[model samples]
Target chain A: MSTLETAAQPEYLCRIAIDPLSRVEGHGKVTLFTDRDHHIRQARLHIVEFRGFEKFIQGRPYWEVPVVVQRLCGICPVSHNLAASKAVDQLVGAHEITPTAEKIRRLMHYGQTLQSHAVHFFHLASPDFLFEFDAEVARRNIGGVMADYPDVARQGVRLRKYGQEVIRVTAGKRVHGTGNVPGGVNKALTLQERNYLLADLDLMIQWGRNIVKLIKQAYALNPGYFSDFATIRSNYLSLVRADGALDLYHGGLRTKNDQGQILFDHLDYRRYAQVLREQVKPWSYMKFPFINSLGPDRGWYRVGPLARINNCDFIPTPLAEDERREFAALGEGQPVHLTLAYHWARMIELLHAAEAIHELLLDPDIFGDELVVRGEMAREGVGVIEAPRGTLFHHYRINEDGLIEKANLIVSTTNNNQAMNESIRQVAERYLDGKELTEPLLNQIEVAVRAYDPCLSCATHALGQMPLYVELVEAETGTVMDCLVRDADGTFRHSG
Target chain B: MSEEQSFTLDGRRVPFQAGQTIMAAALAAGVYIPHLCFNREFAPHGSCRVCLVGVNGRMQAACTTPAAAGQTVESETGEIREIRRGILQMLFVEGNHVCPACEKSGACQLQAVAYYVGMLAPHYTHFYPRRPVDASHPEAVIDFNRCILCELCVRASRDVDGKNVFAVQGRGIEAHLVVNTPSGKLGATDFSIHDKAAQVCPTGAILTKHRGYEIPIGQRLYDRKPISVVGDVATLSESKGGRRHD
Candidate 1:
């Protein structure tokens, strides 16, 4: 792996970079600048890849957008598929889909949320929480979790596989399934497919409860540190049902300030442009989105499990709601700003997804025959959903010929851009400020970023690339003092 | 009539009728020859040379080359398969054929033929040519980027539909399929979704509107069986009385 030029400014006497962040969905770099006394001055997370899916998807037929946009990210393609499908439904003038179609889509979304959060908590983020943050790199991964905690590791794999099976039965494949169409879905759940998913429903729910308990126990081991680690105060945004229930598939927009005060509720998502605006910076490829009323600096907020859990009134499911009550008490009736609490909140959603899947499986609507509905055509449409990562938006304008003239997508990871940077800066200040650069210190920065479970590929719209590099350099002579590279295969080594 | 005409293909004797191409004779005798852009319903176009085989020490397109008495045609040979793979690769790079997101992924003739011939990857830099998509038609959409100059639709519209609604324009790399309409859009023409032209495309270029991925990937035509086993979609549609299972 070749090292690029250090992105250090001349104002700082030293620079440290964590390039090609490991265990994240896509490629990104974190650069920290320090003064002569090794006091870290500034930290920035840089998205180095560029993907222009919005531009390329401009001329495609409106109906193809749901399937074609799945190319954005392999991890959360179902989210993109459903989001684009919802937008296409509006383009076809089907403001509301049929009952069967709605149920099928909800099942697919919950399956996606279940699988995605399972992978993040069990496979990606568990290694850090189960092991010491400064543990050796070799033993700080899923393999190590398997070696030490076999049951936890086995359940994680099974839970993830079960979620994938749910996707397969509903959408037709584990990845890039083609179940959703413009106005509705193309197929309904069959008896065999339903039975296949039902056989594992109870076990998945049981495992879901077990994993949630696992994360809570892990958090309890070091409450003070885990609660304070990478913690920050920022606004939260998500979607909630009209009755103030947490709705992952569809709902009106909601946002809350750092103090848990509602900034907006039941706001029509179609008018999102009236409230949200994106800011582009030269340093990073990911766009910074902020509330239109608050401006860039303070308006920038957090999205994903923590934000969704904090912004919503209650999770509709019984078990997750009980967990939510306990989690809410941690904040003392305010929003929980702890970054590591994200994993705990994420587990709650996983259980909710399991319970939701159980409920949908028992409902006969999923097996109904009326799967599609259509109406008069429209020129413009917008779709918004609470993806596993956070709020995802897909908007499009089509010509009279039904060809897409323009497209704009604000993915879940893009919604967390500024908040991720802030968390990284906070971690850098607390862990590495006025200290010698070490591998453990660098891992702390990554731990903070991974708390958000950022899919950099989705944020940058890139594909087939994730290589991270970390470099510590002397700013005076522009000489590299230390360098570390993490290849795409998740192997790391020291280099010049 | 005396002894039937025959040819030796890959060491197997293939019986043929009078005035039949090598490809026709092979398919008639239940033998598989990898091909694209050649259909049994229409006269052999022989444009996509994926059916190249060694005929008496000469490389020839099986769809256009005639079968003769005792002629030896060597197919499935390593060298011939390599050339076929190269031709398939060029066809892939020449057009923006993104199979993953394509609506006709599993059932597309081009994709099936590529798989049959073991064309693993594009094996060449993609041209990524910018092309236009005409979705004006009420029943169909035409994505010109995926057109491989196969001329199947051009022939189907002109001969079967008798409308002459489709034609090929330009030359060489610039050659493209066009709707023969005053507005140059499929909606402006008298083309119907039932036209043979709509079902004859070997790629995702010409697709029926609002009906994509109706058959799941694993259950689609080529997904269940190889193109060599199930035959091309056009011939299968014809055999099924003009109704496509895909």
Candidate 2:
């Protein structure tokens, strides 16, 4: 009999696991399986918890949907806030909101993107990039980054603080603000608040440029290493303005295939159900979303920073446009599929956000008194926005009494599930070996997953405490052989 | 009642009337005991448990426990604070407390109490329990999902409004507030927006109609200051009982 067929043998079983994956917003685990010969067979990323938000929201008032769903993720509440607001706006029968309301919503969205992207780059992903992934666990962290490159670390902190300040000044607080409403925002920006944000524009713009410059320097240090790391070619999706310029707040849905060919463009988001559908996998609480034309397997597409940068023809702002061109060049006349490119694209978007904020602040309409537009009620509506991570879809159906009958939310990370798995497999094949399971090898898997900056919290509507444990197990007996425990602060040590 | 008595509250000698509970004495003396469902206008209902305080090295609900002379009452102590946070966590998990989406968020006593007690994250498992929202009332809505079972509405409806329109119907986790009407609908009852019961909800469970965001969130009662400073102010300000658009 073939050794691979020997299922009863305990020693022949092989599994590698990274539980409660670190640095991400919420709980997730990675499990790698190999055959008896130790040939890697499959690698799967499992979302362990489910919040059942869709099921629980059944009888909630439609007006409350926006505010309630924002609780899904403290890291990206504004995305859910605005997405739910847009969906309810349709239900309220206001096809277009007032000019002032639109500007305020746009401002909030930009603030969210800037803050979320900053936290990911500085707090979550930068440690792996700045310190080599193989560096000592203690020395490879924000503290280490601070000790070695104090200026860069300081800038990152200051930049994130500035983004948070924008959110606080505009939305009432840094997280779970009650500023957004169904037809528009609750209130307009006062001149004092506007001036407060505008005063920091110069410093923020400079810091954004410095961040892009710093990323370029890091890329220069190891051009070939990042260029070929965890690369996966797939279809990309995002929102674009009518002229095909990048738009985060309101626009038509656009998607491109791996060859940089536009699969579709300028499609109405309200008609999303006709062209898009989600397929649930038993392995994950998160659903895999794909274009209806391509079916589940072939239809899988990528979303978030790299996807947005790739799918958009141009950015509206000049500084970000320049960076966009430079980024596009790295694709070698095609789409850039290197997972590491997400970090670089994120910086470019950050610059665009600062520029966009500056532009919005300059407009006098931002100070208008007209904040909300109450319209006739409708039964159903859909809202879509390009969240910091990617395009987010919130669809709701309400009864005559204005209570939610159903709610289906396709968060940013759900769209990337297939691509994330593919990237993990590619990473596993490159670094995971039966001979050894080192921390750096595990970090390689982490780096690949971190590229997407997946917020499993939002993706799965998850909350509560999770145990962070890594295990090397025997698949036959389902027994843990060796384990590593990760503390809440992201430090790891051998548990067994 | 006899002469006035005083207790050491968080190291401050706060004087109280003989008949007053620790929560009432604290509020009367300008000291805040963070609470929900214990309105100054109504009798004490310690159903929320957010006002738990350390008294003589033992935990007790400040709203229900009478202030004793010379007794050491610790409301702001770490152990007391942790207990309050645990109560808040339980309320958060037991019901659908989506603060971001609720109309009463900034003005909500439960939300403000949560903030005051430093319950930064809902550190417990979310029940995500499927609850009902009753929008049958034209001038008000009752979202049972946000109910913390404080019984303020039931007390106000029964005693203050003289309507007897609401009551607690079930027990344990299944315990819930129910409408007292032939059709079991708020719309079918004489529950008006002007009812005292409608204005007494600590959470968004009972909200006035068409007044969502009447005042922008930042300028709301609790938003203007921490709940510690705005204690009972959200309820006391409603004595005037009229909406003002800021």
Candidate 3:
């Protein structure tokens, strides 16, 4: 059966769509097909925006690729920055960057991960979870959280702000900082800036623990609902250290089968194209990435937080290691297929990030001055990093004249595209009925998608205003039956 | 110098010598006027129009309009700011000012000016013009795609560098920065990397070879402070060739 056909249910003849999916990064929609009998036939998540960063970077100078390609996603610029920089580092034949440069880059990566995850948890996903998913539309934003739980909201803002501050200090400015260069980074952390960030580490750690406890409590309060909602089984993929420990900044790529057995271990990222392949579907602009050996049917694997936690054997940090033990227990010797567990896993990573930052700060190398190493230039190279969302890859081929001949970027979100569709389908199958399309039903579908904290902007490389809305269209006649619109600021209204 | 008469600029007292334009007067008085294509070392060519100011409720180029005594000039007002922002947007779309990839990013007057005026989003449609990059020169490269048609290179080459190797060719929207050689290549001309034209580019149009990202990014000239306090285009245009040999 074809990929789109996998969601087939002959009984359904109508469509239920969550257009311009809200609380996500960019523009997307979830379309569910059902018959007159109210049984879901098929469901697919369609990424609406299409940006071709891969094509245009060609012909530009090789040194410019790192900077040019980072424009792919504003929210995750540091991911692109480091990925592109690492790719160029290969082109320059710099196999090992100086210690200071590596540490500084690692610091910046952690900052990006911390801030991005904080925003996803507090500003985006927490709203749904905090307000019980079916809360009034108007009181379901950051403002609403501020009014209800002012202290928790303040902690979120403060933690996210600290992450931004760390990024700003290490990268020059918070957004689109030009710190990462071809060979390595362009600057090092100053003593003053280090002290400033050092001052916040304690508070950030405390807040990270508090938030983790809150999420843990939430999971405990409704374990069954959280675990079963939109749940699906898929393979897991992430980068692991030599000992199979969680290493987001630098590590070897690893993949495990759905049963949690290692499929590939310590494989070089340059050979990623060999193990992974992209399958395009006509319905969505986003491509489906699957394991090359398994093919499309069972090759689809999960990435980001849950996958990272599942694939890694251990977390090096003390508190995160404890949380990892608990998280692992959820799977009971196998990979956790619970979709809502992604949020819990994200918090664990957040705690790990806080601990990692403290370790990096104490390292004397982070304050050193040898940031870049000049070297012989090569024709081709690839760089990969575990972004806040998932593993991001940037590969480039340059001509002898130092101009880029070809470029290909695999953003983190694209890896989860197929799995996201599968999760949406699971939600639709569970709650969606053709008898009546209700707001709560529409929101449940959204909650499933949001659990991934997918950055659609990075996934599709979108431009222009991204509006979120859901429509129920008759599959037979392609006519709209019901529609819900979500404005830019997270305000929901039933338009039709 | 006619007693160096003072004029009201953005409600601040700025004194100017005879024959100085509003931009020069503001620069000297430590006040910033957002501009491109207007340099103090050479004659002011108000071609970029990014520094258009309101004088007595009339729009005029700050680089060419002389500072008159007791004249009310508004440079930072809402209307003038909007006009400057619009002009910057037009310049952005006119050429591909890829700041992230450009060598002159942190030190580029264009980027700094854009930041100063708070031009966050490019509201207008992007032309995404397909311009060419001339890398024929061994020591210098000219990326026409980043040129804002400021003519700073043209003037610097003719006036200060005395190379006459650069010129603005064509007219109106179709105009472009061109090398004087018959082949229109920097390598075909005698323009040295040390030429003032090479140093005076407000954007990353003209860059010296092997010196790309040499100064790094954060610790670069303009990274520490705003362009207004970092000596504007005049001080930035001055050669600082003693740092490293490329």
Candidate 4:
């Protein structure tokens, strides 16, 4: 009977596509191919948009780069701004900025990281964790979370707002503030700004602790499922202080294996090209960056909050350090490979950011009048920082006229491109393989992608454009069986 | 002075001294005509045409058109405003006036004049011409991209600094500011940061190095008040001891 049934039907491959991924910063799509039995064959995360900020920034004056690069990501403009400013610092030959300048930039960065991580968790990722994966689409959103858990919703809003206030006081405006210049900062923290931030520092720190606890509880609700969902064993990369503590603003590059074995440590980011090579694929506009030693297949690694948490020996702050200890134990003294753990790790870092902000606020040097420093000029400079999502690199070369001759930027999301694809594949195989497709099942793939908090806009270097579409196709005849497009306006349409 | 010569400007009588242009007379009477290339300290170049107004039924640059007793000038009329807005828009598209990234954004006279004339956007296609930034100067940087060919720096260098450090070389769209030095670099020229040419640029063309965003955005020269109330950078520099311009 089985042989007769097999001979009666033709086995053909089918494809499922999720385009213009929602709840992410920019446009991305996922495509999965399966056989007649719905056994997953191939999975790909495609970055469709392209923005050549690196190309257009060429020929601009080097001094304007910090401000110009801020156009890369509105959510993390301060990260780009500070990274470019650090590169420009080398151009101006001020390899070491004044203590006050360093502290001021650190304060700004902490504020940015705090706000960005807050936004990603509370606004984008919380809906998935707070509700069942199979919950109705409308009920598995931020609006649903707000309606059901008003206290959680209110805390998230206040947390993000507090972080923005920190940025406004340190940077100037909460968005594209001109806080950092070539050699140093543009402005010092005023007494009024300092006092205003200080008034809320304790409350923000407490809120940060509360949010971390909230994510912990969310993870505990389904530890077995959460720990294994889209889990993959891969290398992690981030920046760590000279003493092996996590330092978001300034640090040397560090990479570790899945088993928590250090691959490289204390490597100067200026030598990044020596160890890293970006491989381009025809399918996606985003480049796949991998460790040169490992090559593309095994060289590709994870970044951002999870990677930072995994790669660092310890977070310096007391509250975050304790949380880190608990989080690390999840792997039994090894790196946590759970993708959903990104939220837990992100909350820990958010607490660290709040603590860092508190420390910097008390430092008297932040208000010093000596804001800028200068020296002989250099022709080339490279800057790297641990941005909210992951590591960010800004490299530039200038001509004799002080015009930018060339620029290369490897943003955080770009670094995790391969990891994101791998995570999507893992989830697609586990949840989508051999199963009837549904809206909830499709969201599983997105849940994995969102674990990285991927900023497709930042990765693609594109402006405001994000739309997702999904398509199912038959491989034998190359016919699309079903199609779903989520327009840029957030409206969805289903058609064949 | 003898009986002051006066002109009826936008229905207001503006008194003028002998040999003063309508723009100078109107400015002296606390009235703003939304100009770019005209400065009180220099001979009216009348090149930008931003201050164009109807004079007795004919359009003329207020800076070059001499004021006369009982002469009627129309500056605040809808037709005159539209013309001014067009001129401002043209000036914007002609150069790379990225105000958000410009150091002189709030203090820039061209931006102020554009705002005073209600220019909401650059209405024409932008001519994103490649321009060089002369940053070799230790104290000053000249971004040629922001230059509108107003010749204020050229005139200021020649008339006030007594050094012919800058000049406009090309004609029409090809016209651009060039340093008088053989190297064609601002650093190679005998131009000091203190030179009047350094402070006379209507845009971010000529800016002092290491002083960008010094005063922050909200507290800059034009941020606190409209150009109509505070006048241009030159007037503020002259009256307020250059405190506001920088």
Candidate 5:
């Protein structure tokens, strides 16, 4: 989006809207500002679009939402898809899906986390560690990382590729493939696909070793590179399974305040709004989220890396345990409040996920019989699976005629609205140095902002918003400079 | 409540759960609804109106309308009656519903539905769109011209399917199923009929080649009788209050 002209000294405002950020699954944007003191005054995330999938599907059939929304994020489709599918299964009162099928889906969910994390570490954030943060602007890139440590880059690429490959064989196509369904999968995998997946599983072993080495090296060489010029922290949150296992794709909400104390854990999904509430600010369209009890300013619990690491009890995979310990060491153990520690946390999850995927392949019925449980058409249901970004819930109210009358969707990214805003504000306040304002600083802010891997598209959604209004305010006078209801992507239009 | 006005199939009474449609009760009882567009998650959109049946004295579309109390629905009516005949004819005339030569013939729900309604001719003039066939997925195929705008495929895509891959474009009779992506193809977008939403299609509009005939015609759905009879044989735990039995 183009910046509006301000008569008063243009307090450098960078509005970065990246639709379908390359190497990432969904669309989102980052905004930061430098005040008169040149000190960063404000940073906001504008999620203008909304699939309104939640409202759009008020009465839509239950099973379809998972598949439909799974594609919403090409990167982490299965998690949201399964979460929604599971929620739908609960809604209609259908029998639980086969243990094997559910296990396969869980395995797939881990694959999603693995692939998404590798993408962030290798392609998204590697440039900073490879070329020191203080290094020349142009020198920072995948090329820079490869120039010094080719093996790290290669391993990262291979690990991510293995994750995508796992999705391909079990689900069919690599990105948002078929095979997952409410009752069960459409078709069981063939022996060939199964064997191929197991063989491919070995690649992550070598790749995971490289991941540890790289993270350790980055910490040792330039610990400050991972340091927070943007000193900030927020309450962390995540989901856990019934057995108290770390639930990536299936779990209720759990949260911890910045003080490193568990605030809430194992809250039922139906009452998610009771704990997490939306807070939309006038400056930006993106809705800020907070613990409902505390309200807006007081509630700022973060989801994703910070949340998952703080909330999860034990890392299922052994390799990931050491990485987690190393991360805890950064912020002095217990509940690490340092936001940059998200990088380390994300890596540990990736390492753990790779192992989970391997374990899933070993299940005898991974491609065995019982793909679907045949059913009558009149059943109503809700599916609640976790998207890579956050918790995704799909609720369907099917009419006797079996038509969709209403649909309610609560996606994962939206689950972190409040924490996202607070994180942005803290980062902006800390990093926006007054004197020398360069674009690289702004870009790094965007990248660091993305370290959380926000899914604004999934959060803002689509088709749900008919007309999105963009109101520009003059920072000096604090007056409404101009209010235009721009079409969702920030293209100002006279008409809706 | 004493006699219960009970109905049983093979000594087992369907629960006939309240709010539960005959289809759901039947499926719960292991009975199947021969529907193409009806998926579990999405709200039913009964545009194709193929799932028409007689409830009590009136006729209604199974997917859109409700299954009320003390209702008896006929899946197969003698002579393929006006509503079923009209639905079949319109379905035939709407798309390139050319059977026999088409791969989905024999196993197709349109053909099966047409057979159930005893449809022999396309009474209305054919207004076929010279639409291209989209066989994009290395596995799946999409032939627009041969499609019967049943919207089950469309509904499946949006509601149950989730991807919203298929959409109804062009108004009125001019409407045809268009792929939501740039290429206007299923493969281009994330779609595979392998799922219930995609595979639930009834007509030749969305067919899976190998799975068919593989089950044999005599044993195939609707061939033994209508879905109502097959559906009736499966319902269990008959509801004491008025419930739907197709």
Candidate 6:
């Protein structure tokens, strides 16, 4: 009986959860568990809500879906509009689209990425850099940046406003733009509109350069600043054009392992099951999208900033490439294994996108005519675009009557399941000493998770408005942890 | 419809769809109907009678009129045009709409449609009422003096947003948009100019608070283009500030 009793036993199950994780576009949570050796046993990331846009879009006309989907997120509405319209265009299968329309479409995509990426950094990510992560939530906003370095804040606003103007001039509205269509863009950019944008664009060019310099100066001043977050190497994925350029809208998929070896390139999307697998866990609503051949039990992969940096063959823009090379110098390796390095990588991508935009605007077709695709709506198709967070995949199957029959939205956050899980574990393993956890350190882990800007509400719950409230419960006693909250300026603010 | 319909709008016989509004059928039939508050953007609320059409009997909002498949729809007739003019006259009379001084004058949907229907003179006495202007939002303005009470903003806030940031408080003509989220300003609430509900005003009621002088009048909406210009707009993020609130 004593011999039969001998067995491998489970040890401590460390559970962690952070509701309303800071630094992300929307609300989210991260949970992880570990044994006594600090070995990660399990990790789950739950984005607990969905607005059911796909189901609601059932009977609405296809053209209206882009506009409706644009309302899904105030942060990156134009990206949704572009992806939806592109999907509708593919289904229509019109080959008659003129070059001028293509020019406008590319310009719009550039404009959307420009504004969204700008907001992602200037408005969202910079807070952690400018203010202490442990600082009071009330004072850790744009005002925080203003108080510490007003010049940076002012420059950010100038840069951000300039990028948004491109959207305003072309999309008519920035957030919920609708000027794009399946056949082509709705209108041509007038000479006058172009001139209006040119002045601000000139200002942005100066500001963008200054931003790179500031980041470089900060890095030089603190050489070891990145070592703390480095070494989170995971299999990375991104979209690159036929020439392996960093293409935002039109591109084929590129997936690579941590060794910088090209595992796959331009794989047909219809056979996506061959490359990706979703392992559903009971703890989290989000599905773990592991590299299919990587095996099921073998988990942990990263996406968004870190993944994009790892997967890319080379930086496209000249200036961005230099900065990217400098970034690689911090950790001399093929795939830098640092999660914190994601911020620097993201800034490089932003610089690249801005430079590419200026080049695209110079194309003569952008100012020409020939819009609209001639076709009847009676087909189904897919449109994949790069959201500010990651690659956003939208698949729709419409009926002959031109109504949506089914919709599958694999958003930016959904694609990076393995990566996020790995990042959480890595952070936990590194930060959580063999000691009781403090509130601020836990929140730092939360901020680290949200650097991807995962829009979980857009990921799941495709039926109605998703409302998720994460509560802290006492494990044995089943008592609620007191969460003190007060209404501050019509929004919930917490002070302990 | 099973019902045989024939209608003469501007001396043309147009078959009207059963249960379809006169404006809806006319729009489907390629007739250019002018209206300020009536946008297909939302279901017809009938707050603006700019789409006033002469039915078989009395004047009606073409957007709200039901075409019974057999009904005659007089859309472009002189009498209907004259009614539209009077509605504009009353709309202008009820508020302070100084076109020469207004920012939305050239690009304003109201002024453009009014010009299309020939509302040359107000032909009515001005109300000369003093209304509150909310300049609380650093990026948007709510000028009650320029509001036409078309309920576009109200409906946008209540119906679309599911957030009642804006409401028509008080009774009768005294009804005005009340901001219940403190300080009577949009910025005070979770509201920002980016919300669809906030920026969809038909008249000069709610105006873009910033970047007015950035783009000259010659390049603004309607003055240089049409609503169909939706496809031509480019998406540029460099110079924009994301809405103050997500």
TM-score of chain B of each: 0.94, 0.92, 0.91, 0.94, 0.68, 0.81
Pairs of colliding residues, candidate 3: A12-A34, A12-A35, A13-A34, A13-A35, A14-A475, A19-A469, A19-A470, A20-A468, A38-A434
Query: Model 2, A1-496: lDDT tens per residue?
Result: 0122122433565767787677777878888767655566668888777878888778777877777788888888999889998998888877889999899888888887888888888877788778888887776667777888898788778778888877776677788787877788777888998988998788888889988988888889999888878887899999999999999998999989899999889999988889888988766778888899999877889998899899888999999999999989999878888899899999999999999999999999999998888778889999999998888999999876778898888989888888888888887777674546667787788788888989887633221123467677876687777787766555767886
The candidate with the higher lDDT, 1 or 6, is: 1
Supply the DockQ value of model 6.
Answer: 0.03
lDDT of each: 0.86, 0.81, 0.81, 0.84, 0.59, 0.64
lDDT of 4 by residue, A35-131 (tens): 7787777778888778888998887788888887887887888989998999999999999999999999999899889988888888888888888
Residue-level lDDT tens digits of model 1 in A386-405: 99999999999999888889
lDDT of 6 by residue, B45-72 (tens): 8877777777766777888877664455
* Candidate 1 displacement at residue A122 in angstroms: 1.6
| Best model number under lDDT | 1
Alpha-carbon interface RMSD for all candidates, in angstroms: 1.6, 2.2, 2.6, 2.3, 14.0, 15.9
Ranking by lDDT: 1, 4, 2, 3, 6, 5
Candidate 3 chain A lDDT trough over 10 residues, lowest sum: A459-468
TM-score-based ranking: 1, 4, 3, 2, 6, 5
Q: For candidate 3, give the lDDT of residue B59.
A: 91
**i-RMS of candidate 4:** 2.3
- Which stretches of candidate 6 lie above 4 Å from their native place? A1-17, A31-43, A95-97, A135-138, A220-225, A270-274, A296-301, A329-333, A375-378, A458-473, A480-496, B1-246
Instruction: Write the residue-wise lDDT of candidate 2 on B1-246 in tens digits.
Output: 567679999899999887889998898899988888788888887877888888998888999999889999888888788988998998899998866566776677788788888998899999898777788887788888788888888888899899999989878978988999877899899988888887777777887653455556557777667766655533665522322223
Which model scores highest in DockQ?
Answer: 1
Kept native contacts, fraction for each prediction: 0.39, 0.50, 0.32, 0.32, 0.00, 0.00
The reply for model 4, stretches above 4 Å from the true place, is A1-13, A459-468, A475-478, A485-493, B134-140, B161-165, B178-194, B209-211, B235-246
- Higher-scoring candidate on TM-score, 3 or 4: 4
TM-score of each: 0.94, 0.82, 0.86, 0.92, 0.61, 0.64
Which one is best on TM-score? 1
Task: Provide the TM-score of chain A alone for each candidate, in the order shown.
Answer: 0.95, 0.94, 0.94, 0.93, 0.81, 0.85
Candidates' RMSD to native: 3.7, 6.0, 4.7, 4.4, 17.4, 17.0
lDDT of 4 at A310: 89
- Model 3 ranges with Cα > 4 A deviation: A1-12, A433-435, A459-469, A475-480, A483-496, B1-93, B98-102, B111-128, B136-138, B155-164, B180-183, B187-191, B209-229, B232-246
